[model samples]
Target: MSKLTFADMQNPLFLHPSDGSSSIQIEKLHGPEDYRSWRRQMEIILTSKRKLGFATATVTRSTEDATLGDQWDSCNNMVIAWIHTNLSPSIKKSVLFFTTAREVWKHLETRFALSNGSRKYKLNKDSYGLKQNSTSVYDYFPTLNVIWEEMDSMNMLPIITTVSDEVKRNLEEVEKRKGESKLFQFLNGLDEVYVPMRSQLLMMNLLPSVETASSVIQQEELQRQLLSNPRHDMEMSAMFSRGQTGGDRVVVCKECGGKVHLSDKCWYVVGFPNGHPNHGRILMKPGSMNQSWSIWNKNNPGNKPKPAGNVAGSASNAVVFSPQQLEQLMQLLPSLSKQPSKASKTDDKLDSHFSGMMSYHNALNNDLGWIIDSGASDHMTPHFQKLIMPTLVTNLTPNIKLPTGDTVAITHM
Candidate 1:
């Protein structure tokens, strides 16, 4: 097969057994189709590299050929003879390359099995001089190995390296273009796959005689063309009531004057109650201590505090309070002269310091802002006890009494 036809040149089934002592073995083929498949397998190996070894033994069907079997007793020698004598080095190279890949596969498989099934793994005396608890072949390493295998199959090591470097660069660019479109990620992925084709397109001449050119146009070029053509990206402006716990936020874009909503990407001001029209206003009771201060301020003339004399004891630097200066200082102390703003009285009552039963339940649900009172046996709130009894966690200790001499024992999970 041509290179393009066999672009995927690696054998899928050629996994070397993970046992260290075992070598690859090819079973005898029966039919023509089976033999052809075997030959293709050999082709895949020898076309890639040279020097493959196998584990095989010959059975003497007759006494006459019994002596011949002795020569083929060594499996490695037998395979080497079969490769160099019967097949070209092209086949040899492919065989050896296939073997190497299999060897790598077996190594990884052994590691994966060990990591998954054993608490401790043994190593050779000089094997990388690794630590006791080094990272295993599983985890993210498996994903990386799949990529490596794909690259090896395609004979695209250079391409893989280039793509990896390019990916890093693209990620940096993405970081630079923070808060840009999520669609940009698709462009980044596309660029990695299209690198070879796009480079070829760049090298070709753009002649006038050419009616149309086969192209590997970049997403950036496409984006630029779209921008020039004035086709806007579709987006929606959603006005959220703003009590959402997540970062699902809508921010106006400075460039297009469009609203872009990002979920879990924005921070919210904590303790700010949602949907409160008078949230910014701090209110006091009509005759409370704070209100009394306000009323005294509005009625009193200016009585600005003067700075104490400096170490030099110069009283000249301290300003002599004029009637107007004193009057303005008096105005500044709104707490002393005027009553608290009458506007806040009609608004909703201020939130209480102590949490209600529902609020405590919410805290438990969120795994935050909950207090496990040590001196309690069974839940105090009847509503909470009913709902949380099924999932509640309790200690071995006996029940304790609260300050009001009530006893309850359970704690929340």
Candidate 2:
């Protein structure tokens, strides 16, 4: 026992628990596997209980004052017992009979902390091998942080009263290199989908920190999620098209031919849904649906629109020339102007070509200009002599109603 200090005498209860209790509690220490973390927990508890001095050897047993010496012995015993109580059964056997709390704590440190090469090597290997394979960036980052924190604790620099400028620069460089290395490790371990993003990151003039890189990576992840959401929605809509309704019946849209919905909700007929890719697309009017479809169908099946007056004969006429020949014939007059001329020809040759073009039309007594508009849907020319070979249509009758309520019957095909 040593002599009691004046400070100890002045403040006799300075080492007493801050919370006014001495029963310190913590999880049982599980040996070298959790020795560092267990030690941290014990230290925090000891500090809070005002018994850190016992473990730190700051309050030695004193005999100058018998009362102080006894107090010291009692507190030391309490500290020793608390450490033993919070250790595993096997660990307690090694340190339970120690004479002082400080000695026991130091012994545990020397035994487990000094020879931690295996733990450091494992931590390095894990950090090197960790990947964001199936895990999200959010989960992968936290997992990496845990491993990094453990490694940081193992490689902590020695604490000094003051660091020199050279030492400070060295430390800063080491930290910078360490942060850059960690960024590479994080970027490299990500799935191949991040290759473009990784290239962008590497191309930057000043590399970002780990935390910043993580934030950017998370942003990219969110963007990918947003982009993929629409495709997933499209797939789900297709699934619904094939899926059954509540009653196990499939409800189809007559207008769009899709299942699970009606014509009123049809995108092709009513309107495209918001956020759908098909904007500025041609849409069908609800009134012009199946009712008038046959008029435009050109197939000319039965059940055509009823005319207002006397019906016409079968109006479906077969052309004398094939579509290809007609197209070629139509190109002749247009190509004459478009064809580049190497030399100008006399007006006599042009006049002969014009004569052959008019030869297709009959020499009628009427002085009306002829219009060969092949693309016209409906023709109402007064001169009926333009028909190459007139034929009477009697099987099908489609009457055309005049503006004055009187209907004109189509007499010829």
Candidate 3:
């Protein structure tokens, strides 16, 4: 048997003109994981360049013509060059001495394509198991389409039709079913909010194209946005409207004479009629009707009719005085006497005394002594030193009258 020569592998009739076009730049295969995609891309390039026959053809040496031998060597070298440029450096050593493209191609196939069954199994599992989860529809469908296309190319997907039709109706039906399967898978991966839309799609006699379905889903998303944001809808409406008032209109409050007053802020709601309860009432000289009413309405800029005037002997009316009112009036006379008919001056002293007393009481510490008193009718202190946390009572009137007609001065407690 004679060893094969380059002439025997050359095809004399094969002719292809050089066009000075760049080679298709397929990505270099990194490892076993990249084999399938790399192979697909390289095959496309080889076919387009009219060099696929060189890669697929068997090498044999039956003739030794010098011209044929040179042509064969040129074709083989071109194929080898193309293959070598597209291989990663790590895998180059194994195929460095390969004289024919077939050898290199076959070696790669044998080494990496061993896991085809496992690859097919994994692809099938992934295709069926894919879910939208956190992925958006735009992001998710492309991935699914890629997987579907890969499966179809591998002949891994089941054949839906074998019978022939003149118009290729059977083929169309197969494609339609494939589209529906993809649509169903996409819908399944969607959130439950799309359940109604999914049902509508499923119920249709013919499913919409994926692009159409995507558009509908996008519209659904817009509708969802509009539904969730009422303020946004209102703003959009307002933008389209012709100079309409956009928010709650301000109305004049009848009671407080203010604009946009809340019901809670209304004088009537706050338990004050005729604006404020204290607005038109006299604080001193409860018995004198004429003098009190004159002073009460003196500051009224709007001459509004006094509601208290009609109800005689009402608390706001000058003729009325309860026992507590009478006592308060008697106490006011001394304070008023010092200022002699100047009510504002008398009010200042009264406010100062009450405020000062309240401040003093609040300042007192709450820590009480542990000392217990038994059979005591009245509170008593044995000595000042025995009072562990005594607070000095200051600036108050000296004496407090007891029920037994005795008055005692409060010093410290």
Question: Residue by residue across 1-413, what tens digits does model 1's lDDT show?
Answer: 54433433233212224412213235433332233334445546543432232321122223467644443233234334444343334434434543333343233234333231121122221122322132322232233333333323433223344457778898677644431221222222332434564455446564211112112233434554667763343222122313332345546433223345332331122222556764654443233433433443344323222232222353443324456746655664663346455433312111111222121111112223333222223335434522322465756476644444466775553
What would the per-residue lDDT of candidate 3 be over residues 79-107, giving only the tens digit for each residue?
Answer: 77778888889887779999888889988
Measured by TM-score, how close is model 1 to the native structure? 0.16
Q: Which stretches of candidate 3 lie over 4 Å from their true place?
A: 1-22, 58-68, 114-117, 156-169, 218-413
**Could you tell me the C-alpha RMSD of candidate 3 in Å?**
18.4
Candidate 2 lDDT tens digits, 1-413? 98778776445235544432236667788867778878888888877766887888886778698987888777777778888878889988988678998999999998878455888898889998998987899999898888888889788988867889998899899999999989988998888998999999999999999899999999999998888776888767667756656554678777767667878777876667778887656654444434434333343343233322221352233123446745656766565677556334524344434332321111222235543333323454445554434577775567865434466777675
How many clashing pairs in candidate 3? 0
TM-score of 3: 0.46
Model 1, position 331, has a per-residue lDDT of 61
Question: In model 1, where is the ten-residue run with the lowest total lDDT?
Answer: 357-366
Best by TM-score: 2
By TM-score rank, best first, the candidates go 2, 3, 1
Where in model 2 is the C-alpha error above 4 Å? 1-27, 48-50, 114-116, 158-168, 222-413
Better structure of 1 and 2 per lDDT: 2
User: lDDT scores for all predictions?
Assistant: 0.35, 0.70, 0.64
